[model samples]
Target chain A: DTAVSQTPKYLVTQMGNDKSIKCEQNLGHDTMYWYKQDSKKFLKIMFSYNNKELIINETVPNRFSPKSPDKAHLNLHINSLELGDSAVYFCASSQRGGGSGNTIYFGEGSWLTVV
Target chain B: SQQGEEDPQALSIQEGENATMNCSYKTSINNLQWYRQNSGRGLVHLILIRSNEREKHSGRLRVTLDTSKKSSSLLITASRAADTASYFCATGSNNDMRFGAGTRLTVKP
Candidate 1:
């Protein structure tokens, strides 16, 4: 079974178009995160939720919003997407937060390309 | 801003050779982790080294942490073609964890 899964493996949209990517984890983890990997392969944490509570919110713009309906699902919604938003989005989860000896599990990443 | 930064940016080696990637971080961390990402794939956790620990080994992957220097290194011995991927280092603090830019490794057969 895939521990972490993300929908819409590939997405191509135009500017000002809104899109959403869904993520789910079956590892029973308490912490879930959304990361953005740019063309340079630089991975940056955008948001993190622990047990459905927003814990870490990086300096991402308000256009990117993360919602966690429960402990098992975290979804990312982008409003009025821009060209700079093209990147691979990864959904990851861990047993808990703070990285206290916990190994993060990542999904097969959703590739987003804004035209 | 990324807390960790990987050195060399990229590495090329033969199938039987060894690959080494270094990571340097800005602040103190509870632990450091190494992850691998294949082309068009997600990052996979490889290993982790704690602040109190100096070195750790998992199979052919060896990791070393130096708190004083605020740096860590990941060494993969007898690298194979399948080992070709981008290696990243992550620094985990109290409630935050950040990843580096990553070093792309190409192991030619």
Candidate 2:
């Protein structure tokens, strides 16, 4: 089974439109994260949730909001998306404690293109 | 802010040759991990080296960490064409883990 999975492997939408991507991990992990990869393949952490609690929130704009209904799920919603929003979004999960638990497992990724 | 920065944005090598990638982080870390991502695919965990360890080996991959310098290196031996992909270094401190821009490696068959 896929350990970490995200919906809409690919998405294309017009400017000003709102879109949401859902993510879930079956690994029974306590922490989940959302990362954005730009055209240059620079991956940046947008948000991180530990056991449904917001832990890390980068300098991303308010247009980007992350919601975690439970520890195994974290979703991202983009409001009034701009052309700069075109990038690949990745969902990942990892255990909370130290040691090997720090290893992160990533989903296939969702490609978003805002026109 | 990104914690790690990989040296040599890109690398090319022939099969059977070894490829080395270096990573430097700004802050102290609990552990450092290397991940490989193919074109249009998600990142896959390669190996992890903790702050207390200086070297680790898994198969043909070797990882070294120097907490004093806050840097790490990943060496891949006997490279194959299938190894052509982008490699990333991530630094984990407490609950926050950050990734670098990554090194794009092209292994010519």
Candidate 3:
């Protein structure tokens, strides 16, 4: 019954390792997004998908890729993880592709720590 | 990068008082929204003020937007200890919604 959910609330991995975070939204939304919040608490957008179509891909590193097998799920996979990759990743969703006063729902956030 | 930076990184208030936090953005926005995060929990949407609207209210929450100034403010009236949480302002453009660093409010009992 959760609107938006993410797996592995906390993740720890060594440098050069690979990791993946799964996200799902049961709100029947057409827009999904991935956001990263650093230790400084600056939340930034990484990627966005509208009904399973890649829409907005920010200046994120190429090593990181977002895969959406369906409209309800958006997974993030990190390759050659670096120490800087340690941050809180949030999954969010909205009813439409643009903001028309539509509120976006966020998950509990996946805390990733690359040692 | 279309980042909506919230001012006053932290705020501390006492019960029965009011709390106000401000956010400023550099680019145009379709709509601005406010969210609340209760510690380790997920962020909950508090309110959304569209470009055409000047203000919106929801229970104890009040949000005011001024697109001319490219800024917005959230005011919480009759604050309580339960209001202790991080408040963030997010602006959505197209399919992307960017969040600020958030204002960590500590409401003392």
What DockQ do you compute for every candidate structure?
0.73, 0.59, 0.75
TM-score of each: 0.98, 0.97, 0.96
After superposing candidate 3 on the true structure, give the runs of residues whose Cα lies further than 4 Å from its correct spot.
Answer: none
Give the per-residue lDDT digits (tens) of candidate 1, residues B12-59.
999999999999999888899999999988889999999999999999
Higher TM-score: candidate 1 or 3?
A: 1
Give residue A51's lDDT in candidate 3 (0 to 100): 86
lDDT of 2 by residue, A1-115 (tens): 9999999999999999999999999999998999999999999988888999998899889999999999999999999999999999999999983224378899999999999
- Scored by lDDT, model 2 comes in at 0.91
For TM-score, the strongest prediction is 1
Which residue pairs overlap in candidate 2's backbone? none
Q: In model 3, what lDDT does residue B3 have?
A: 61
Better of 2 and 3 by lDDT: 2
Which scores higher on DockQ, 1 or 2? 1
> Candidate 1's residue-wise lDDT over A2-114, tens digit each?
99999999999999999999999999999999999999999999998999999899989999999999999999999999999999999999988646878898999999999
Least accurate stretch of 10 residues (summed lDDT) in model 3 chain A? A96-105
User: How much lDDT does each candidate structure score?
Assistant: 0.93, 0.91, 0.90
Instruction: Point to the candidate with the largest lDDT.
Output: 1
True contacts kept of each: 0.69, 0.48, 0.83
Ranking by lDDT: 1, 2, 3
When 1 and 3 are scored with lDDT, the better candidate is: 1
The CA lDDT at A109 in model 1 is 98
Clashes of each: 0, 0, 0
